[model samples]
Target: MARTAVPPKKTIVKKMNYLTGFLLGFGLLLSGCNKDDDGVTKPDGPDPNAANLDVQDFMYKAMNLWYFWQGEVDILADDAFATDAEYTDFLEANPNPETFYFDVLLFSDDRFSFLSEDYKELTQNLSGISQNNGMEFGLVAFSNSDDIFGYVRYIIPNSDASTKNIERGDIFIGVDGVTLTRNNYTELLFGDNATYTLTMANITDGQISANGEEVTLTKEEGFQENPVFITKTFDVSGTKIGYLMYNGFTNEFDEQLNEAFGQLKADGATELVIDFRYNGGGSVNSSRLLSSMIYGTNTNELYIRQRWNDKIQAAFSPSDLEDYFAATTGSGTPINTLNLSRVYVLTTSSTASASELVINGLDPYINVIQVGTTTRGKNEFSLTMVDDPNRQGAPYIYTPSRENNINPDNSWAIQPLVGRNENSVGFSDYTGGFAPEIELQEDLENLGVLGELDEPLLARAIQEITGAGAKFDFTVEMPAEAFTSSKMFSPLKDNMVLDKDFYLPEIQ
Candidate 1:
């Protein structure tokens, strides 16, 4: 029999309806429970006045809304008869929602318990100290110009210790052996349930001494910086390839990236590798900035499209495009551009949110050859915030007040908007993630460190860029085991590979 030619398969974008179906189906699976003999619903309300009630209610409402927005009806079955546990579990699945809710719940519960046990402990300790000396015992605000100058906000006074000996304006230099810096203050003093002998010095005398102290402080929870680590680079034949290790986007991240790229470019880097192995996410704007620099001057859509619900309906209109364009292009001012037209990105299961945006956005305009593993399919975006009730003197919590879809069309393009969706112009079909143009085996041994220039993948990229059969091969041999741990790989890993064959056509 004669062999028949198979036509090239057409790319299909994911539709909004399909995503709605998946979310609904998953939610229903989560809500499922073993049926009873009676086949009747059982009462499933929590105990009256239990603190968990508020959490339960919020979870149920949020999960239902999320499901509804996604158009998942199977999971939206009449909520009137739903159990509290089921609802809570549904909300828990949302990215980091449980952390916000549970942390507050746990802290509130434990705080009251501590207060009850040690209600008069401070008073008792201060009274004893005052009786032994000729000084008043009270807590004083350690401030400069009414703003907290140091991490030690409150201090107990001792009479025998003397007001003159330890004045209100005393600067706290250290606690225990740890130097008092703004970064580690809360972690060292309060977060860890450790007793600290605070070292302080009077503003007037500048005499530093360790005061006999035994007080418990609770560390207020705060967000920490997520840094991108670049490991090492080697020559792939004649092409100098560099690897950049990055996890998430941050406000001050542009400077860090600019410096790294500047060095790489100066060192004769012809091709670059970006590793997003365990990156979660950060600002969408940061992703745009990075994408802009990599792709150079081009009109590239960073996302397929964005969706707006009734709450943020204004965001869905075309008028918002001007703002989006301005934010992306940097306020009409001429911007410095990187001439590099493409980049190789290493992705894994942990790559999500803004990371996805960067990949999806640039795949259309440049060569974003994804290596390693498939990325976490999290195309949705949300604005997050936290409110300090004490400082604001009111309840403040980061709430997702508005929802916006990144794509120009309000419907899902990765899947499809609806019905039979057409293949998007200039966009690749990346339902889960863009597949590697050249698949390469991951070497577990040289995991966290950058691979040698002679590695098969890097060699291919060099061959493509510098033409085949280059005279020099910049290959370095390193230990394989060094690549396993995330910490050990600062920015680059030894076994890291970029699928080099992936390339876009040069503009004619």
Candidate 2:
């Protein structure tokens, strides 16, 4: 059948005036009833054949309602099925919710949509709480060979790695004495092993070889990271340039981030350089808040416009589409904005999603001098969709407050690409990622202190700000290209999340 899916303006029959119903309003009545004609329950409704297909219902419905490429996926199309039975059958066919989410429901173009088995875990991850080893590192393959090696990007303070001999610029050629390759790096370094030994590598006269030293690290739950890594002001040709090596846009650290800005402001920083080299991404609101801290807190100035799927868009009012520059931190602390015209951003392959959002969202308002490499090219924002127990089989955007309301039957939550975010000028096309105006890459040979003026990326930004170039060699030996990082493993950190208070069209 030809699927000409057109969005209905008023489709939801709200059971009650509640956020639960409002969030679950878009999808069709999701209660699975096998009997075709009347209100009678069919004996076949509890088909043993449909066993383990429980959460796929939630997954399919959520994707159908909110997925950015919903129209492109044939099964998710509004008219794809003739009856409720057909849709139920499809959900049953794919018993595994993860398989259904990854294989059947997702668009081929989607690169970042992910699912967590438990909404609790997912929420924790988005909040920057997780099982961590305290080591923030990047994994890359040798330029001339298939041998994979891990490098310490930075160590999270009070963590196991910080207590160990490992420090930034250190490389590990193996984990637990096993030589790392492209295939086994994930298993060796990131696997379930609570503790593992990292065999260090030595750079002797331009060649890297395995050294005898090994560092053992352990993973701990609820390990939270402060995204505001290091804040320092530099004297660049008498111009006070504020340097903020921000790692993630974690909302939990919003107030701390604001305070960091306050410090920069107090330091008489006329110029700003934000190092986003190792950052992947995080909360969109946090990105907005951070943008507000850098730019002015002009509440009237639009920060970002959320571009939802047509189904959602058709129901939204004009005002519901845009999010403005935040005036206060999430905790009601007044933002200490720099109000600077020009800002330098240090970016790399790891700088993605919400990290990219800050650059794109602020472009029409300021001069963003991008240093280092191109970004990871994710312009889409995702909503964490989980089953709402109050409304059976209905998916609601997961919020920390409504954790108890999540379906006890289904722990599954999908972080699906529900929208593409645009700036005030309606520019969202950074799928190929924003290229650097000043092309530079971090030298593996000379990985300097992050907050210090010696870091290659920071030095270059200072050069641009001061016009008196920092005395640093631009040459790189064994230029590393990261395949993945510790941040990449934390999908929630990389996600541009839209959580509670997000604009949902009023269900009339």
- Give the best candidate by TM-score: 2
Q: Tell me the lDDT of candidate 1.
A: 0.37
Tens digits of per-residue lDDT, candidate 2, 1-508, equal 1111112223221110001112433432333344333343322222345455558766776676668898899887655565656656776677776677777888877766777787776566555577888899888788777788888899998887788898999988998889999888888877889899989998777777988888889998778888889999887668899989889877778888889999999999989999999887767788899899888999999998878787677767778677899898877899999998878999998887888889988888998889988887777876667886344323466656677777788888777777888888888877767888888887778888888887788888887777774487877775657877887776354666654443343321
For model 1, residues 189-300, the per-residue Cα lDDT tens digits are 4344424454553332322334543222222222123344554556755567777766556535566665566677667776777766556554555566666656564443
TM-score of each: 0.44, 0.86
Q: Give the C-alpha miss distance for residue 80 in model 1, angstroms.
A: 6.5
Q: What's the CA error at residue 204 for candidate 2, in Å? A: 2.6
Give candidate 1 regions above 4 Å deviation.
1-52, 64-70, 74-228, 231-242, 263-270, 298-304, 308-315, 319-336, 383-431, 446-448, 451-460, 463-508
Clashing pairs in 2: none
Q: After best superposition, candidate 1 residue 269: deviation in angstroms?
A: 4.8
